[model samples]
Target: MYSKGWIMMELTMNWITLRVRNLEASLDFYHRILGLPVERRFESRGKQIVMLGIEGQPKLELIEGSDPPVKPECGVSVGFEVASLDKAMAELAKEGIPVARGPIAPNPSLRFFYILDPDGFEVQLAEHM
Candidate 1:
């Protein structure tokens, strides 16, 4: 029987894995284009894999594949937070990437913009309002 003293499980995000067509190219894009720092790297079966993470956030695993390039599409994107919305968007512009949206409030307590990643993923660069 369950006891009243039993504590509920807490929700936490430890890490995420992203499948890519090319490990080295994807790693370069993520690190050089997206500017995520590489925290860990590894290999398996002659294939390369790398893990990256943001400042103090959980790691993101990048796995290499041998497939055609994946195209980007709307609604298939991830989100990342930045210190300043305007600054982040401006910086992305230098990479020939444009912000699809501005620092508009998606909901209360937040300001964000949607930036299209290379794979058609919508990356949200957000900040607290």
Candidate 2:
């Protein structure tokens, strides 16, 4: 027999998985350009999954698929906070990644910009002002 009340369980984010058209290119963009370290790589159920992130942090998982979802031009976006937006933008420029939109300030305390990943996914980079 088991008594049921409120079972407290430790919960934290594990990963954010995105379906990608090209695993190698996506991996290069994230691992080389964005500088996320490769956490692990493995194949499961005929699909290849690559995980990237800093150790002990939430990861971004790239799953290989023939028909991945098309990223909308203006609806959905993923965001990341950076220490310095200037440095991030400069690094991105050096890599030939164009800013799709703003280095706009949504508010006085925050600045952000947008860029498209290899799979056409929009990524937002922000810094606290």
Candidate 3:
């Protein structure tokens, strides 16, 4: 028999892994551009992997040389919180990374924009007002 309170299930996002074509380029985008520090890096099954994130937060894992190479899907993106969208855009401009989409504020408390990573993955940066 099933009861509403009988099942105990907890869900959390541990990490997101992406198979990248170029490790250094991806590293430049994620580590240098986005300023995410590399937490740890290691090799698994002959493939190199890098995890990037702030302490005690979900990680974004970048993997290179994985079997059955994968292409990033369109319309799928990873969003990040930014202190200021204007500052982020200026920094990106200095690095010559163009904005893929707008700094749209659909509501009173949100503004955001998108940029393409080295692997053509959509990276969204948002600032809450």
Candidate 4:
């Protein structure tokens, strides 16, 4: 039997996987645009997979799928924290990547905005005040 204060098993987030139609486009956005470094890459069952993240953290995996991949569900998004929202926004604008939604601050302590990835999945960039 396990004691009240003892843990039997610990859980942690491993990674988030996104199916992408164009691997080059996805890499351009995620690597060049957002500045995520590629952790590793491999192939399985005729499909290529690329993982990106910092050391000792959960990764973002992009799996190469069929051209014209299936549409992602509505209202699902992944958010990343930025040191400066204004700088990030400026960089994005320089790249000609339009903001799909808000640079809205619902509260004084937070500000955020959304952009669409190549596959039309929502990607959010936020900064804490």
Candidate 5:
């Protein structure tokens, strides 16, 4: 049989890891408030890690550790797509999470808002027409 010259591999993002000061609070915010399911929780190298996301989707890993010196606002914002921006905003308000900026329409077909997580990380929730 002739040997294949090359094989194509599909690549996709697995997760995004965030170093958190309060693991429990972060877990509550992401899992309870944002409605991301807990995929798993485990300890590694004496550090606690919580993975949150629905099955078949990219997971968000929250690791308990000393916070780095970098300010949360100094980097790119993490974006999440929501079914309805208004409903998401209402939920955020109900949870006492103030909107940093937002509900702005980038174009006719899209709306978005920004809110800070428990650690001051900016997260954008967007809705598309």
Candidate 6:
């Protein structure tokens, strides 16, 4: 007999893998600039993929690919919700990393900044009060 009260689970993303041109450079941006830690790294099929973790959260996999996609200029921005916009900007400035857009208080309750990764991908640093 078939069950009538069971709920089916759907497939979900365990990790997000970004195809990048340079694996090491991409990893460094995420680790150094973005402040993500390397959770695990290994190789498969002669290609390398590095997984990054932020605190206790599951991380992203930066994979080396032959033909990297040209990431959209003004769409689907990868936003990193930060603890402090000033702190983040300070750290980035110390490392000689300049934000394309400096920290701005758009309103009384929020602020954000923007920077480009080595591959020219946009990263938005957001803070909420």
Q: What is the lDDT of residue 46 in candidate 1?
A: 70
Candidate 6 local distance difference test against the native: 0.79
Candidate 2: Cα lDDT at 55: 91
Estimate, for each residue in 32-127, the C-alpha lDDT of model 2 and write its tens digit.
Answer: 998889999999888899999989989999999766555666466667889999999999999999999998997999999999988788889999
| Residue 50, candidate 4: alpha-carbon lDDT | 94
Output the TM-score of candidate 3: 0.89
- Tens digits of per-residue lDDT, candidate 6, 43-83, equal 98888889887756656778887765567473545677888
Q: Model 1, 122: alpha-carbon shift in Å?
A: 1.9
Clash number for model 1? Answer: 4
Off by over 4 Å in 1: 1-11, 54-56, 67-75
TM-score of each: 0.73, 0.85, 0.89, 0.88, 0.88, 0.78
Task: Give the backbone clash total of model 3.
Answer: 0
Please identify model 2 stretches exceeding 4 Å from their true place. Answer: 1-10
Tell me how many clashing residue pairs each candidate has: 4, 0, 0, 0, 0, 0
lDDT of candidates 1 onward, in order: 0.72, 0.87, 0.89, 0.89, 0.87, 0.79
Arranged by TM-score with the best first, the candidates are 3, 4, 5, 2, 6, 1
Give the better candidate number (1 or 4) by TM-score. Answer: 4
> Per-residue lDDT for 72 in model 1?
60
The positional error of residue 19 in candidate 4, measured at the CA in angstroms, is: 0.4
Considering lDDT, where higher is better, how would the candidates rank from best to worst?
Answer: 4, 3, 2, 5, 6, 1
Candidate 4 accuracy as lDDT: 0.89
Report the alpha-carbon TM-score of model 4 versus the true structure. 0.88
lDDT for each residue of candidate 3 in 48-70, tens digit (9 for 90 to 100)? 89999999999999899855435
